[model samples]
Target: MHPSFTQRVTALEGLRARTRQATAEFYQKPGVMPPPLAPLIIVRSSGNNTFSLINRATGEVIAERFGHNNATSHARELEADIKRFNVKQFGRHLRDWALRISAILFLFAFFGSHA
Candidate 1:
């Protein structure tokens, strides 16, 4: 049998607490610094077929929308947010890939022309 919504939420909260404790301990070692914690989002469906976007770190309801369609849309929005955050975090390295590819193509073209 499927667990009820409250049970699932409780489990998730427990897991989050444990993870936070572990992270704190790991960073307490000498010469180690802790970075900002990432936002952990959870999507859950209720018995009534409604969906919620929850922030596991703060146990906040990011959003609560009804129906499967709205849930899917919200999921997509969350995905976009993650992508945006990744771009902001590692965008410079990603942009370097374009330059590297261009350099490789230029070398290929130049070498092929001489052949």
Candidate 2:
């Protein structure tokens, strides 16, 4: 996965660490310049083989890579797309108030519970 979240196999701290690492690495990737993104959200499309990194608080899609693999090279194609990409990142709306902190913590908690 793009984030390598390890949701079912690791602890909350692990997920946090991986998420941070992934975010850092993502920013470090050659030519992947992000713009004022906060509380980034990584999404794996349920109905398709698309993986995306977004700014949930702003409904902005910073990057996207298609395929069952999140590490695919398809991510390189989003330079121009990233500049114009914008959309809702409010999740499923099942939790209308999934504030950034809560949402990130919930990702860890939800995975911890499953593990």
Candidate whose TM-score is highest: 1
lDDT per residue, candidate 2, 1-115, as tens digits?
Answer: 5455666446787888999999998999999987764323545463567676555667676667676466234433343355453555435353566676698898999999999
| Alpha-carbon TM-score of each model against the true structure | 0.35, 0.23
| TM match of model 2 to true structure | 0.23
Instruction: Put down candidate 1 lDDT per residue, 1-115, tens digits, no spaces.
Output: 4579889999999999999999989999999977855546677786497888787777777888888788768866885777675756688887899899999999999999999
lDDT leader: 1
Enumerate residue pairs that collide in model 1: none
Consecutive 10-residue window with the lowest summed lDDT within model 1: 36-45
Regions of candidate 2 where Cα sits further than 4 Å from its true position: 1-10, 37-115
